[model samples]
Target: MSVQPQSFSSLEQNTESENHSSSSQSWTIEDSEQTYQIQGWGDPYFSINRAGHITVSPQGDRGTSLDLYELVTALRKRNIGLPILIRFPEILADRVERLYACFDRAISRYNYQGSYRGVFPIKCNQHRHLVESLVKCGTPHQLGLEVGSKPELMIALATLNPLQISEKEAQSSLLICNGYKDREYIETALLSRRLGYETILVVEQLEELELIQAISEELAIYPAIGIRAKLGTRGTGRWGSSTGDRAKFGLTIWQILQAVETLKSYNKLDCLQLLHFHIGSQVSSIRVIKEAIREAAQIYVELTNLGANLNYLDVGGGLAVDYDGSKTQKNNASKNYNMQNYANDIVAEVKEACDQAEIKVPTLISESGRAIASHQGVLIFDVLGSNEPPVTPPPVIEEEEHLIIRNLWETYALINEENYQEYYHDAIQFKQEAISLFNFSYLSLKERARAEQLYWACCAKVFEIIKHQETINEELQSIANILTSIYYINLSIFQSAPDHWAIDQLFPIMPIHRLNEPPSKRAILADLTCDSDGKISQFINPKGQKPKDFLELHPLDNNQPYYLGMFLVGAYQEIMGNLHNLFGDTNVVHIRTHGKGYKIEQLVRGDTITEVLAQTQYSSEELLENLRRHTEQALEKNLISLAESRRLLNNYQQGLANYTYLKANDQESCIP
Candidate 1:
């Protein structure tokens, strides 16, 4: 039987019917939550309310939820520009409390005699406010700080300085110093110990131990020591290589024993108070964590038997945050275990190892910086515009049109359900032929434009047919790519989400409002940076499938603003982001949840044009002077009027002082 051909309009009508039928299902806030997978990664903290706005319950599910849309609206009233970062201090506090509480439960259940102590790794996020807030929140738990560099050590020492004021506070707080230490670094850490902070200088290499011994003797202060053992059990993730014998930091079995013997000879084996091992950050599997802990625990017990005074078992930060919410080991973006499961396993493994060896269960220390900080920060940006294939009826082809263009038009006109595959193939062939013909000067520019338009229209038609189907063949899937729009967002991937661009790290991104409505468009986000790589093509898949290339989004409303939030970026994103295209930072506001509302505690302004230029060695005053000189020359030559020169210079000066990001239109600031 011959398949009947359908007109282009008929194909569109069919697609509209299919879309209306599919989207006609009642979409609620719950449906929105599922579509965005907010519950998967954002459980207990974020949800969509009945009013169609994303709500953040900073204190978790039991606390009052604040509307993110409303919060942005309030900030807009004060004229905050696009691409602002919103931080919830309460979420950080809540994460800390939950982390300690889980370990407490595990310790109680296992009857482990050692107490649990958590230290925030300063390298994870070095924002002063974020570090200070974590310190304050953890003061109750006597939460400590971990530093891996000279700068991070400086911050840790100063941030924890308040603890040194009171002897009780000093004893309660623990400061772990990691990384290869220099003389000044060792002296500073040892001096802090002398001043009564429970500082442990974790020896990363055998050489570091010698420096520690010499520095301590000179400072006349006995330094508390920890050994970072190179574990035999390897990790499993992007950062997994940092573990095992080939690891960059940490000493091997031979080196570790040498350090012990050297410490014994120096009579400083009594200073060996902690054993540390890192199995890499963002651990993907619970089995890996268990294995690493068992190996490290064995080493801890053996060190104790070797007469090294070990009072602390430090599991350096490998705790993972489930950015994709898969909760499976299939990918590196997520973890296969929850925080409680991790705690239980650590406590069980360590206690079993210690009980077998008949040794004391030393204090359990975890540097869980990612889990504590990832969820607390959200980067929000506006959708400036979208670039999509023209849906307007293809321009009427004259009779004299080229044969290649004629073939494309016929394919677009006669595509039907039965022969769309054949027609799609024909269109591709015709488009390629037209491109070759145009390059050979066989086709006019107008003819080429027409051919390109008809090509996209054909793809659009093919996409409409298969979009609602349960499954499409691989060849047919390219139609969806052709139909997807490029949404230009007011965000720089380098300035806000460097990991995504650098390492293919995925963060949960979704519309902040309009949850009651089903999104009708699929788009790949394009950032404002000039670089072609500044775009987010991979998105989190709710079903835990491979990341989707396009994000589902609502049709842009010309009358209102549309915003998207990139969540789980509080860990390394802020500090790791670079000034690509000189985009600088975003306006940051620290929010504290109150009763059914939130208080904006602080607003750190984003970098101005002047500030960013200065970082690149461009003096703003010199820039202005040069521009003024050029403008005066132009006026003297009568190339421009005096009034225009003044106006140009004034605008230039104003632009230098303005925020680095694009300014929001007046229409975008209004609440619908």
Candidate 2:
């Protein structure tokens, strides 16, 4: 028998029915934010404003909200487009001030004698703008720079070289040199002291003592020295493996003793003043920190007993930021303690250890890079579009429909909690038989269509029942996630948020605008890269699955523009990003508030196709030559006339000069 076609009227009616059931109010904006744990994770720095937008509070106050819509409007005029990094220098300043205030509070509450000297690790974020803002804000409170590599040292040295430092200022505002060192690195550290900055060379191994002595003798300059102790107290969190005894860097306890003896032998033990120890980054436990501090503080006392004049206890950078907003240690990304409590725990532990050791309280140094810079950088990107699947009932049920289609439809109509399992099982079994029979041409196309529709309709009803349920079995959970929509985003995940792809790190992702409007779709983000792995499927949720697989995004307005902002991306995201698919960095705009509004202090253009090519040692001239050859072949084959080919080549080359990221081609923006 000939199969009848599904009518358009039936399809339209089914679609409308399906859509009405899953109405927009099914998932409101408030529900979306709550589901994503936005309020929990976005404390102090980010919150939803009355305008239904995520307003940046630069001063850390609830007042003076900077509307992102206005900022985007300003950016359009200035030619600084979206997919930009909106950096608040004032936010950096506030963070620095907050760090100091906490330390100051701890010092005062404990009546501790030593000062808190905070230093920012340059490796976390070495952007010129971030570093400069840090220096400008941190320099006043004697916040210093910690450099692990030669290049980082150079950046620190060059940035600070112009600042005229007096003897008092030099003592207070210090530069710390850490990591594995070569002869050249040691030489550079010693050379930096000539500029009158009290630069400390931290010895990570025992042999580094000889290098420091040799260099000091060669230049007739005595450089300040510190020791990084490999503490027995290891951290617990994402970067915990990088700490402990057998870690990549730091000196063993035996090595630390040997280095101290070597210093004594050279009569330069006073140079061994700063004692540094790092447990790891994003350490969640306060107890781990206290234990580590006790171990290092005792070592500090023992060094003083051995006639080494100890002055500073450098507790290396592990101050965790609340990434998940749970405000508790629910995951590696969430820290249980706040800034003030972190400071108090460290100070009290150190003071008690030193007080019991019968030693003077040494100055405390913390290289809190992540906590300092994480809130300062916000990455903004726009959604190009979305991927939605067909969700409708069958157009018609033919009188002679296949047995499986009739059975499935009957099961769908009979669905209820009491008989859901039975009905769902029957529909699944019948749908499988219908698919197999249709593949072999034993069933008509119209019957096959009806069977498929019947299956989905049953599945949709099952989902609705599952939603009201307090607990769902694993089978139903898989079905729920299977129905998730896909959002196609403009920026490359590798170039923008690498940790999300690499280690499954979840940064706060939400529309910078439209927090007031309810989102209608449960979705995952697909980046611009051809690689399937370049997508963000995991999202933060306190009550749901650990990084519950999908994000809830609003269905596109289709007429107006919309943008999403990724928060706390200041550290490591930019520098660690690879040149995957040759999609370069996004446009960056430094945001600073002026009056009630904001001003773009600087707009740094991202790399072009030609520039990104240069990064991989591919010359632009060579690219043009290859293009020329391809065009010449096309011309000879009569694929294009000489004039059209020339025009095409010129446009291609001009595109090579344009931004590697998406840009507006006309008055209305189109995906590039």
Candidate 3:
């Protein structure tokens, strides 16, 4: 068997009309939550509440649940419309705390002498509320910030003041300056050291090491330095290319030795206090991670043997987020281990390797940005509309029909699991004959239509016999997707989910409300963008199951507005987004959860039409002038009245000032 006994939803629509009503639906919150794999990816922080809404538990599931639907309603009442990015400072702080706690637990468990120093990488979700919260939350834990560019470093530096870090803690905290640094970048980092921030300039190449050494000599500063070794060991999954010999960053083995020799020549080997290597982000397997640690540890020992006074082994961030929520290691979006497992493995590997090499265990630093920031921000957008394929089998024509049409009807009538094999083959042959006869004008239009009706009825019956089978045949499983609904989402795919389009990153998406209602529709979300690629076709299926072609969704009642929330969108999505089709940015709201209720701390409106146009060199003044010229031309031709012309100009100006995205107006209001 390949399909379940349940036929097309339309077949059950009328029969289940009473059960489908809001107050009478029988679906449980737990059952609905399982459909979206809320527990798998959501972990300690997200779950279904009594109200059947997706709720946030910042301190984990045991904490108080904040209903997202309630938040949406509150925000709506406040006049802040959909397609909003919601930032949770509580979740942000909790992530940082949890990440640090894992390492601390591992350290205590292993009796490891060295402490863990977690650094928040500014490149991942570097929004003002998020980075500032990370800095503030990390102060007690002695967490640091890492930057790859000057602007990122500037944000880290400027935010430090507003952050709760004390003067002593700031002086000892690690401010890692990564990437290819120019003279200005190098000097800025060096200047930060003068300001008492413990900044380390991690050399990526021989030339960069030379630059640091030369700069240090001129400035009369014994600058703390680190070397990003190009490792022989490669990472696992999609980001592995960012490591190994093929990687864009870090120093080769020969280059590393040359850099050490150059530093020795400058009598600055003592300045080498950190040994760094990054095997890429979102590492899928702990096995590869342990191997990389073994390799990086050897290099660290060698550097220490060569008399470089290194004290820190900076294991650059790649703590996976389990985006698919499988909690498995098979895919790039998932990792096999939990936070404790990750910390324990890293610590045990470094400890055993260092103990064998007869060297002291160095302080550990992890730049795990994705794990910290991915849960902090969520992109919430609404389903503007939907395009569902016709679900019902067309009514059979009673008048004289083609032979093939009559045969298909007979086959459709006989379709069942007991004789499915025989009826399916007969129906397929009849459908092919009907198509051929119609193409050659041997069959009338009514005959072809009746033949299609019977053909669909046959297919629907075949599907009914297979959907719930233990293992559906690949070919049979694909048939159901043909009838999948195309949900027209309000947000732009390029602007909110660029990774989905660029790298096929899977983010958990589900409706915030109506978890108690059984979803009747299976859909693939299509965005408002004109490009064909602007859609979310692939979705996370159940554990050990293949990815689904369509996401199960509730039927869209035209009177009521439907809202869908895309979860774990905090990292990379914010910065990588583009103005594809000129769908300029969405609204943003900062949410902080408390004992009972959450507060809307801040609200940032998205770009207006004029603002977006200005980015492309079409200023409001220029657009107004162009409109004025057109109106004058029309006036010269006596095409309109002066009053009408004024009204037209006013409307055009208002359009320019309004948000580029469709606004929620009276016509688009949600029905009660």
Candidate 4:
């Protein structure tokens, strides 16, 4: 049966105007014509053009036009294939610099008393290139580092310490230690402080504060202290409860007061210099953030009023970056607030709240890991193939035909009339009856095949008649939706985008090329895995509509490679990816934009069979030896020839040398 055609609106139409100052503007396609203009957060950077092509711009760079077509061309030239993660250091630096600028502008505007310091949390994308870029970009601002684990701490300490970057700017970036602590963790924090780094041990539990105090005293170092308070106002996203009473970390109100009294009693209240609280990550709504910030600011004032030497309000990392351009609620991928608004709201609320409470405005410290790191990386994967609808054979009629077949043929003929509603209903009923009769063994195999063919023909005719109607029935619409094609992708959801499969995190996914042509198919993506659950049924269409489908893609073009980009994956994907099916990490390429164009500075190959086996304590040499011995014995037994045995061994070694997935160049060699 021929597929029915469907038309989709432009993505620009879905963008809502955001509230921005006169100085800040937005980008949009004007008048449904194919023209691109840069706008502020009011207009979505990602939208479908009139041709139904997905267009995207990296956050913050407005005037510079980098559409999907340009991105694909630049990426393909480097020979990076499917499941490749692209790192744009320029975009990362821009985000880091813009954040500091926003805070700097806010500080100057309000004449705020306290200093502002920001850090990139290592928990979000700890890839070497990303972290290096963050450190380099943030060196001007003395950007700090936040660590939650030993590995993350190692990365931060190794990169952010004064020893790494000898410049005066590098010496200024501080290190903030978070998460569960043990003896080694505390020792590392103290050691970092000893290395001339301003290390702040954020106390999640009161017991941790005591442990930290003891460690500081024992080590003979005056380490700074930051207390994470469990605020009453909770955020509204996936990581929303990260700050409230039910949060995994932070102290309760009573506990905070008790800790302050204990510190004062010990004359260590001066060490209690920073107050921290994390409402959540990817906080979509501004109202929730405003409320949470106001609550935290009030606590900061209370601590100050109690004569605690709290100089910094460590607003622990909730500044969100919108992954999906649609500013929807609790999507994890989208946010309702922008950077300027976030900074302004924090500064204004703190100033007002502190003034009301009769306390000094504490210095603002943010641990914005995702916002700093998410935009720096992009996961580019090629579409190896697509699943097309199966072709139906033409119906054959006999002189002595069954009654059901005759009735089906008659119904198919009736469906072609102009006023076809009644005929369509009759056709549908007759088809269902024919199918039931065939299933019940009332019809022969040949008759059943003819009935099925006639049924599909009737249905196809009915769809043709209703295709132009603006308002179709719900049942017909559902059928049409199912008929929408689905494309099978070449990447694993568990490996590349674990958050999407695990936490329902929606990253902005679009075709990396073909932006100039109208996409003919309404498609959902399927991954190459043995599991049936490896398909991506939900997608943000060019019109910004959420379309879920099982079969909505056209046949794959074997001649040319198809690619889909999973954007905003720079945050947690790398660190969170699992070894499901032993399909290790994707090959990572760090792309830096220069005057000449984009350059691939680093290419980290994905984990090979040897590397993956090493993790399980298996030696490749031993495995090869055993396989060779087995094959030799089989050859001696005449199960295989000597030539075949050698060929097999060589093939096995070659397989081990190659990547897990086949590249475009590999298709040229056909093994006889």
Candidate 2 lDDT over 246-314, as tens digits, reads: 887888888888887788899998888788889988888777887888888788888888888888899
Clashing pairs in 2: 29-518, 40-325, 41-325
Clashes in predicted model 1:
0
- Candidate 3 local lDDT, 306-346, one digit each (tens): 99999999999889998777878777778888889999988
Measured with C-alpha atoms, the lDDT of residue 260 in candidate 3 is: 84
TM-score to native of every candidate shown: 0.95, 0.92, 0.92, 0.85
lDDT of each: 0.87, 0.81, 0.82, 0.70
State the displacement of the C-alpha of residue 392, model 2, in Å, after optimal TM-score superposition: 1.9
Instruction: Report the alpha-carbon TM-score of model 1 versus the true structure.
Output: 0.95
Worst 10 residues of 1 by lDDT: 161-170
Tens-digit lDDT track of model 4 for 131-206: 8878887777788888998888888878874533534334545788889999889988887876788888888888
Clashing pairs in 1: none
Q: What is the number of backbone collisions in each predicted candidate, taken in the order shown?
A: 0, 3, 9, 18
RMSD of each: 3.1, 3.3, 4.1, 7.5
Report the lDDT of model 3 for residue 371.
91
* lDDT value for model 1: 0.87
Give the TM-score (vs. native) of candidate 3. 0.92
Model 2 whole-model lDDT (C-alpha atoms): 0.81
Residue 395 Cα positional deviation in candidate 3, in Å, after optimal superposition: 2.2
